[model samples]
Target: MTRTNASLIGFSAVALWSLLALFTVASAPVPPLQLSALTFAIGGVLGLVWLWVRGDLKALRAVPLKAYVFGTLGLFGYHFLYFTALRLAPPAEAGLICYMWPLLIVVFSGLLPGETLRKGHILGAMLAFLGAGLIVAGGLSGVSGAITGYAIAFVAALTWAGYSLGSRRMKAVPTAAVAVYCLATAILSGVAHLATEITVWPGSSLGWLAILGLGLGPVGLAFYTWDIGVKGGDIQLLGTASYAAPLLSTLVLVVAGLASASLSLALAAALITGGAVLAARAGRQA
Candidate 1:
């Protein structure tokens, strides 16, 4: 794919995940654990099936156990914990909290070989973190749950950072192979989610449909594209495309009659986006 295409695909994945939130909230009565699990299971099964059809299931044998473990922690652990947080907290809160991954990635990237602290990266990190805080703090009109959910989401963001950092080490790995394993990790999380649920299948057709979207789009395709994007970090357009996710998510909300052109949210977005952009630039220049 061309750089533009790859960037588009990358950001689309982010939007797909964002769009799923509306479906999730519409069906919010379902347990987060179960929903998370179902999404992963479907995504993993599809990935594994594709791997098998392509005769690449054997590739799993060649993967280093350590790297696979890290992938699981990033892909699976992060998803499960984040979903759990959603159940404990509001989606809006969790969403903003989780974007901290970008900032965290900058911090983690600092530890990489030849990765000297850049002023842009430092500044960007501070900006993003501060903006994330404002978005969360400013929009706390009807927050639910204790600080624990927030805490879990925070840890989930760090785990995503860990995943991002570890993903940098897995360069040259086949994109499909990496995606399959990550989906496999997600399936494990889903099984754990189902463990406590009262039923095995989705309660309604809508629920099942959401599961399908969760698997095919967000859990499966999105991650695959993200993995591809991470591998092609040399592409500047990928950064530009990354902005599309929030915008896409916002679009999803608008389409669903969920979010609107609110001065407050716009302001919050400005703070978070501006802050994150500035901090990222500063960190890079550092």
Candidate 2:
């Protein structure tokens, strides 16, 4: 695919992912681990079905064990931490914390071979983190909850950044990597579900719809598109552009009554978006 097309795909994936918090919030009464298992299980099945329909099931043979291991750790680790964080804290606060992945990506990508860390990259990341810190501080005030959850969200950011960086090295096996990721996450989350929480299905239509939406949009197709984008497109631009997703997500939450907007959110949005733009421009110049 053309680079432009690939970037659009990445944007699409981010947009789909923006809805994740809303669906996760709607799927309440289901434990985080169990929710991860169910949605990923459904998504995995759908992915396999897609491969079969496309006559690409043979591609799975090319996937290395390492891909399965790292990809699963990345995909599962992220959502598991993310869902758990949401349950432990307010969704808005937790979401902002988790969105730290984009800045982390810019930071971690610099560590990769052939990638140079620049002043603008550092400057932009600092600005973004400053904004993110404001968000966390603002949201945490007067809120009493498990600090462990917030810490988990931070780890989720790292996991996602690592996953994205690792993915760059596996460009030759994109489809296989994503397939293994889905399957492994499904299996791991299934085990976590059995060990941690009793299985309880979503009892309402809206709940079922949320699961369906998640499986199809974020967990299924979005992963596929992202694998393509990250492997084939300009990773810098895509990573920077990703800052928009959380802002969009927060807006959706506010509209849906799941979260309230605050001055911190607006300020964070400006800082993050502006910083990301600066970074992307700097990358282009370099």
lDDT leader? 2
CA shift at 179, candidate 2, in angstroms? 2.4
Which portions of model 1 miss their true places by more than 4 Å?
Answer: 1-9, 26-28, 52-55, 87-95, 114-116, 128-138, 141-145, 200-203, 234-247, 268-286
lDDT of 1 at 84: 80
lDDT of 1 by residue, 1-286 (tens): 6544654555566667676666666555667666666666676777778788998887777777776667777787887778788767776788678767766666567677655555655565565455445544554677676588889989998887777666766875666665556566756866776675655555688777777777688777777777776555522223323444565566577788887656655665665566545543543454
lDDT of all predictions: 0.64, 0.79
Deviation (Å) of 34 in candidate 2:
1.2
Q: After TM-score superposition, what is the CA distance of residue 268 in candidate 2 from its true location, in Å?
A: 2.8
In model 1, where is the ten-residue run with the lowest total lDDT? Answer: 234-243
Candidate 2 lDDT, tens digit per residue, 43-71? 78888888889888888887777877888
Candidate 1 scores a C-alpha RMSD against the true structure in Å of 3.9
Can you give the lDDT of residue 104 in candidate 1? Answer: 67
For model 1, what is the alpha-carbon lDDT of residue 34? Answer: 65
